[model samples]
Target: MTSSEPTSTRRRLRRLWLPLAIGLVQVAGSYGAYRGQLERREPDALMVVLALIGPIALYWLRQRPVLVLTATTISTLTFMLLQYPYGPVILSFVISVFSAVIAGHRLAGWVAAAALYFGHVLGRIALGINEDGIYQSLAVGAWFVVMVIVAELVRNGRERSAAVARTRKQEELRRAGEERLRIAQELHDVVAHHISLINVQAGVALHLVDRQPEQAGTALAAIKEASKEALVELRSIVGVLRQSDESAPRQPVPGLERLEHLLSRTSGAGLEVYKTSAGLPHALPTSVDRAAFRIIQESLTNVVRHSGATKVGVHLQYGGTFFELWVDDDGNGVPETVVEGNGLVGMRERATALGGTMTTTRSPSGGFRVTAHFPLSAEDERDPD
Candidate 1:
């Protein structure tokens, strides 16, 4: 076993030692008290035997409370029958009560306590003991009541502590979930956007190589720059998933301001593209910016892969309540046979995580369109950036 395992086991053993020691000590002390009674010449052999048995049995009371308690009852009754003072054996009664509480049988414990109390009172009465003295009986009843109250209070305090620990654990889980979502958003933004641009630029370089060799070389150089930048950003974003000593990159991440460069790369790819925006460029939540960027990039990717049409359109509009994004391809719309893939599922998760919505639908003019509606305010509150 590992060193940690032994240390943990040792800790557990240490916790049990004190309680076990207390029980054994109490039993030994009771046995000594009984022997003292025997030396004083008031020795009832039955009382001595009963006293010895009661304390010894109490040591195992928690593990076998019912059996130990049965012994306790028999021993205490034997003492009383032989006309012995019950005061010296009172510790055995308290121990029995403690055992019952630990066993989660409070009613049985109380019943045992009551029986002990009444047995003493009734026996004393029968033996012509003073009936005017009820103080002793009252004292016995009070002691039992106090033990039960203390046991119940201890049980409740432990329950409250457990509830607090559970709440703290749930709060920790919620914070972790939020952190994962923030990282996912950053990955979709930084990696996907730059990768889409690189892919487009690479395609442009390939198409122009034969007709315009010099121009093809310029496109190739741009492609190299875009790919290298994309790889660096991708590595940085992926690093968030690692459990390492290094810190996350604190570089200023791209937002709407970088959209122009992103779109320029696509245009350089020789794809006809148009972009229109209505609102003044405003700072958006990192999640919203990431989501908006992803939706546009994925839509363009779908256009490149599936659509035969030459033109694509991207529209961004920000209102007081929400920010709207629309990407449309004037190509053959998505086929009914097209199965939803991980990319689509990822897009949906991103939208839902931000408390936003996205939909893919066929446009009226025989084209495919993607619409993403994001609640900018709701997202900004939790945006890590």
Candidate 2:
């Protein structure tokens, strides 16, 4: 069988003490307020015992709110019918109503509380029991109304608390999803570019070692450089993912300044890349800079793997308010029905995330082409749909 949640000693005592106190007050203590007694000396012990039973039953009010209220109402009516002095057994019924309302059982609690109040009055009249006065009935009715108002207020408070908890949970999940995506994108960019260079250079080293030992040394040197860059980037990613206490200072994100390193690696892999610019080189915003680098890196990696091109032409132009980028080759172009892969998707996502656009198609020179544009003006973002 399953057990309840573990409760602290203090909490367990608090849970027990209320019902115990209510039961005690209803039993022996209620006799003091009663004008008549069963005998000359002592109060009616049987009546006291029945009153005690009503309040003692309130222990399950939270978990079984409806059942507890219904049972308390029945027991309270039974005691009243037995001609017992009123002993605040109604207190337990009131608490059960509040609990049931907050527990999302408002209709049942209201019905039970209403029945409890009317039932008590009906039982008193039907049994021909003497009540204190008309004023006593008013006081009892007002107290029942007060309990209902309190129950509604408790329900409102609980609903607001539950709504806040749900909002917090949703925000937590959203941030976690974004973090996972960021990590995946970073790892993909790092591994794809560096591993492509390393693979190509390793092949060059093996091929040239048997013929030209000098060319073999150059290939080995390129491999070392590529591996070192890969390790540095991988370590930075590890630092990014480490627990806060174990986290190291982060390396700066790759930007256009790293363009030279990318060009060198591709050059060493035997793909000559020609660069052209229409404007003076200038610093770019962090978002645009990183997106631009990843786009070019993925473009070149794809060219190496897919395009049987000997050379690539790269152009960068800054036309006052926007930056235009193009990477085209003179080799077998991509198929007409190009299936978009992760690299293509990542390039588009990076560009769009920075309020830019990217396109890929077969170039006029019978080679694949990647083109992207970035807006230098913040006006693009400020425009409303």
Candidate 3:
């Protein structure tokens, strides 16, 4: 048998054992009680049948709680009225009350318990067998109250457990959504930046292959380098999906430390690039550092793809509370009706996700400019040196 087969068999046996055990207990206990009672009527066929009715009804209590409770209550009251010796015959009735209450049938369970108690008392009085005093009645009432309290507590505990399960499911879904967004951002940054460079170099190689065949080698080489870098970054991003036992790519995550390599790649695309920095440089939070790098990388990619500018400038500002990134190119400025594309949207999302802000507008040099500001935590502002 498969693993699940044994578990299923165990569950079936678990479900059956309760009623079976209760039936045996009632049959044996009632026979013993009958032997001890000399004043009550002697054991008869109908008495044995009545004692078995409640336990039989209990077998269906989980599936049909209200119906089973009714059946057990009637059988129990009839047994009491007939003056059968008191014993474990009422066990099924008690189980049914708890089952009904826990099945969200509180009103029915309460009424049934009250009816059994009052019915026993009233039935005894009507038959002129009211020998038990008020103290006995009060004691029975206290036990009934205790039973109801315990059932309510079990019901409350089950409800709380279900609520906790629902909250955990929602939290897992939320984390899954965030992870998807992060992967999308990473793929976009990796593909867009490198592919833009490769595209430019490919065009240059084709244009010079016939007239300036000697210079075509340089363009072809740039294309090869760009494609190699793209593959490395893609592997790094895709490594997150690997199984725990599998080896992952050991590439370091891109950050401001890789700014020179990014600038060189952009310069290779035939753009004259200048870089400048202000304020003291310090180690940044990994998230802020990565976001800043992506914003600048995407901005440079947009310049190469859209702006025909031969020159671009990148500026970094490190402050006590914030890190800033700016990229401007001296190409045709953005048209008034130009719509933002995925590259720009991804950059904005990265900045905002890190509690930062980004803006895209036409620069004073008559070209498009992208600027982003990322906040720094106290730890990020600390000097590592």
Candidate 4:
């Protein structure tokens, strides 16, 4: 058998032991308590059956709380009406009432407690059993009220704990979803940018192989460099999924600090890229820096793959409160009916995730232009030097 079978059996036994023990206590304790009250009715077969039935019904309390409460209440009231000596015979009834309340059956628990208390008092009055006075009846009423209040308090605590657990689970699920989206964006940026360069250089190499074999060698070298960079980036992104004991990739993440390297790689693909900066340059928040780099990278990739232009201009404007990035190409712009693809959507998501805004439009030079603005916090304005 599987290991779970034994564990399941143990759990069942643990659940059963409590009610069984209480049943035994009810039977034995009532009989013992009855001996001290010689003036009351002597214990008989009916009393023994009544005491045993209440605790037996308790075994199903968790599954059918209201039914168990009803059964135990009837048995206990019958025992009281018979003028049997007062004892621990009511223990099963008390346990069932508390279980009903804690299990979210407040109405059933309250009604059952009221019926038992009033039934005992009225039954004694109807039978002309005046041995106990009104003070005893009032005292029993007060005790029942206390029991209900205590049960209500315990139920409230359990409900609050359950709500907190549900909220925590939802928060964890939300964070996991966001992390997956980030990884997807990273993979898309790395694969799309490098693959576009490789495709362009391969075409150039094929075109010059027989005509200018020396020019073909340059194209082949560019292909090798692009592929090597792609592999390094792919390894770094995939390393996040590896086991904790495994060594993580030590490659630095690409940010605006590596913009010159990115521009050089683009130029190798036979595109004339011009970069310009305005205003004072300062440090940026890590998130904003990475987002700025990826946005520019994706924009350049789009130009190489779709635009037939030979000249492209990249500009960075560092302002006091907002950092601006613009990429313009002297190529045929996108058609108005063209739908946004994954590359464009991923770029927008990256920008928006860092409280940045991006826009794409036709430039004055009859080419496509992408512009983005990222707001800077006070800490980002400080110079690293």
Cα lDDT over the full model 1 = 0.69
- By TM-score, the better pick of 2 and 4 is 4
Off by over 4 Å in 3: 1-14, 382-385
> What TM-score would candidate 1 get against the native?
0.72
Instruction: Write candidate 3's Cα lDDT for 58-149 as tens digits.
Output: 77777899999999999989988888888898899989989998899999889998999999999888899976799999899789878977
The pairs that clash in candidate 4 are none
lDDT of 4 at 188: 91
Off by over 4 Å in 4: 1-11, 243-245, 382-385
On residues 142-251, what C-alpha lDDT tens digit does candidate 1 reach at each position?
Answer: 97688877866766677688899999999999998988876765565556555655676677777878888788887777778777767777777677667554876655
lDDT digits (tens) for residues 70-185 of candidate 2: 77778777766666555565666667777788888888877887787788777778768655477887787888778887888989998899999999999999998877777778
Worst 10 residues of 3 by lDDT: 241-250
Tell me how many clashing residue pairs each candidate has: 0, 0, 0, 0
Q: What clash pairs does model 1 have?
A: none
Considering TM-score, which of the candidate structures 1 and 2 is the better prediction for this target? 2
User: How far does residue 108 in candidate 2 sit from its true spot (Å)?
Assistant: 1.3
RMSD of 3: 2.8
Please identify model 1 stretches exceeding 4 Å from their true place.
Answer: 1-132, 174-212, 243-245, 248-250, 336-338, 376-385
lDDT of 4 by residue, 345-379 (tens): 98888889878888889988999999998988776
Choose 1 or 4, whichever is better by TM-score.
4
Worst lDDT window (10 residues) for model 2? 376-385
